[model samples]
Target: MCRWMAWLGQPVLIEELLFNTQHGIVDQSLHSRMGAEPTNGDGFGLGWYGSGEGPGLYHSVAPAWGDANLRELAGHIESPLFMAHVRAAIGSAVQPTNCHPFRHENWLFVHNGYIGGLHAVRRDLMLAIEPGLFADVQGSTDTEVVFHVALTFGLREDPIGALERTVGLIEAVAEQHGIPDAVQGTFGVSDGSTLWAVRYATQGPARTLFASSDADAIKRLHPDNPRFARLSAEDRLIVSEPFSDLPGLWHEIPQSSAVTVRHGGVLEHQAFTPRVPVSAAHA
Candidate 1:
């Protein structure tokens, strides 16, 4: 598994979260608290949206903690919306293409769990992807497959629905192979403005996910906390774990739920149950 974070709001230096937090993503690369593994040193990636460009990405097969380029870039670059992920390969090749925050156009996607028995279902799932997207599949990882699956079902038009269908299709195929609990992940996707975070699994238990509280509320609670005061109510963050141990600043996303963060900072969570029920028959 892996650890990741998504930022949507003011264009602040990436260091603010990559290094400045009490337990930042860089730190998590070596000591993650809730990931399936503590050290996600296989690879890492960062994606951000600039003023006019759709999105820019930086990926490396280096351990995030030892990557000097990451530190230098984080200190210099800034974006209103950005995504960072630390990877721990789940039976996939450890390479740059497999590094996360996978991008297409302005959209960026990342995952924090695995698709069980991916090796068994890989061929079937890959064939189901649209021919155009299949041609663009550069990586050999379940995470990339999930991204293309969503795109195959129309992620650009309706992210939530497309993702739902993608997961359903995965479950359907996995069940046919007698693989139980085939899907397990906390996923995040953003199109520069709005962000959608999902916590779901074929089994009942899913990975941990959290979202920050209203920036305005945090400001009122800690008027002197310069960091809180600097952010507007619209600034929002979704993460695999809290960046800081700020009490009451982060809320755990309920299991099987999807959270949407819109432009201007409004955040909402909705309960999400997969349309195709997990068949315990194969379990």
Candidate 2:
């Protein structure tokens, strides 16, 4: 498992969440509260959208807490949308390509869980990826494979559906190999605009996922705080755990559901169930 976060709202320096917050991603890299392990230091990555058409990405095999480059870069880059991830290798190599917030065109993805019993099902799942997308698979981590699998099934057009399909296919393959409860993860995905936080598992409670309350909700909870007063309705932070322990600041995402935050404060929290897509159930 790993720890990660995604931000979508007004432009702000990356360090605001990466380091400056009470228990931000940088701290989580060293002391994650909800991840399977306390330290996710094998590798780290950051992806953000700026003036570029596709988003910029930075990755390293260094522990995030020890990466001075991450410190300096976070202070300089400001983005309206960004994702950061710190990895903890379960059964994969600790390398650059295995680091997350993986990018493909304008999209970036991060995940906090792994394919249960992957070694048994990896081959079959990899073969299911469409040939065109199969070539873009750059890392051996299950997170990267999940991203490519979603792309293979139209992630660009229907993110939620594509993700569900990915899970469905993984479950199908896992079952064929006599593996049960084969997937667990909270995926953070974005296309340089809308951000989606999806939490689900094949047959058990998924990993912990949380999202910052919208401006109005925060204001209602903390009316006297100037910081809460100044927030725009669109400001949102989705993370594996709360950045701060402040009550009412973070809302736990319901299991087997997703929260989609679009431009202009459009928040859609909907139920998510992974079903074998009729089109791929037999494939």
Candidate 3:
């Protein structure tokens, strides 16, 4: 598995989330307390929206903790919405193209779990991607295939629905191949304004996911903490794990749920289950 973090709120230094906290994303890259693997050294990537561009991406087939370029960039660039991912490479090659925070136009996506039986269903999944989007697939990872499948099902128009359809398709193919527990993932996607995050697993157990408490509430609760006080209510962060040691500042996103954060900082959570039909064999 991998570890990732997504930020949406007032523009702040990228390092604030990547390196400054007690167990920031950078720290997690080297010593994740909750991930199945302690060290996610395969590769890393960062994606952020720019002033007038779709999104800017910085990816390297280098460990996040030791990459000098990433350190330099994190120190220099700042965006109100951005995503960073450190890879552990479940069954994929350790290549730049396979790095997370994969981008398409304005959308950015990252996943923190593997597709069960990926190799077995790779051919069917690949053939299912729309031709135009299929040509854009540049990596041999199940994560990339999931992204393309979402695009094929109309991610731009309906992100949640698209993703549900993609998961359904993947599950269907897995069942046909007699593969059990076909999907296992905690995923996050954003389009610079709205963010959609899901914690789910076909086997009913998924990786950890968390979202920061409301900035205003935290500020009120811990008036002396300058860090929390500095943030506006509009600021929000969602990560694979808590970035800091603040006891009440983080809340675990329940398993089998989805969280959506809007531009104005309103957050909503709901039960999330693949709406597509599943076969008994697949389950």
Whose TM-score is greatest here? 2
lDDT of 2 at 246: 76
**lDDT (0-100) at residue 235 of candidate 1?**
92
Residue 96, candidate 3: alpha-carbon lDDT: 87
Q: What is candidate 2's local distance difference test score? A: 0.89
Stretches off by above 4 angstroms in model 2 are 223-226
Q: Listing every candidate in turn, what is its Cα RMSD in Å to the true structure after a full C-alpha superposition?
A: 3.2, 1.3, 2.6
| Tens-place lDDT digits, model 3, residues 242-275 | 9877678889999888999887677899877675
Off by over 4 Å in 1: 276-283
Which candidate ranks first by lDDT, i.e. highest? 2
- Give one clash count per candidate, in the order shown: 1, 0, 0
Per-residue lDDT tens digits for candidate 2, residues 1-283, read 7899998898999998899788998899899888889999999999999997899999999999999999999999999999999999998999999998899899998998889889898887788788887888888899888998889888999999899888988898888889897889899889988998899988778999998888888899889977677789779888999998878899899999999999877779998878786767764
Model 3: residues >4 Å from true position, as ranges? Answer: 277-283
User: What is the clash tally of candidate 1?
Assistant: 1
**Residue 209 deviation, candidate 3, in Å?**
0.5
Please list all clashing residue pairs in model 2, or write none if there are none.
Answer: none
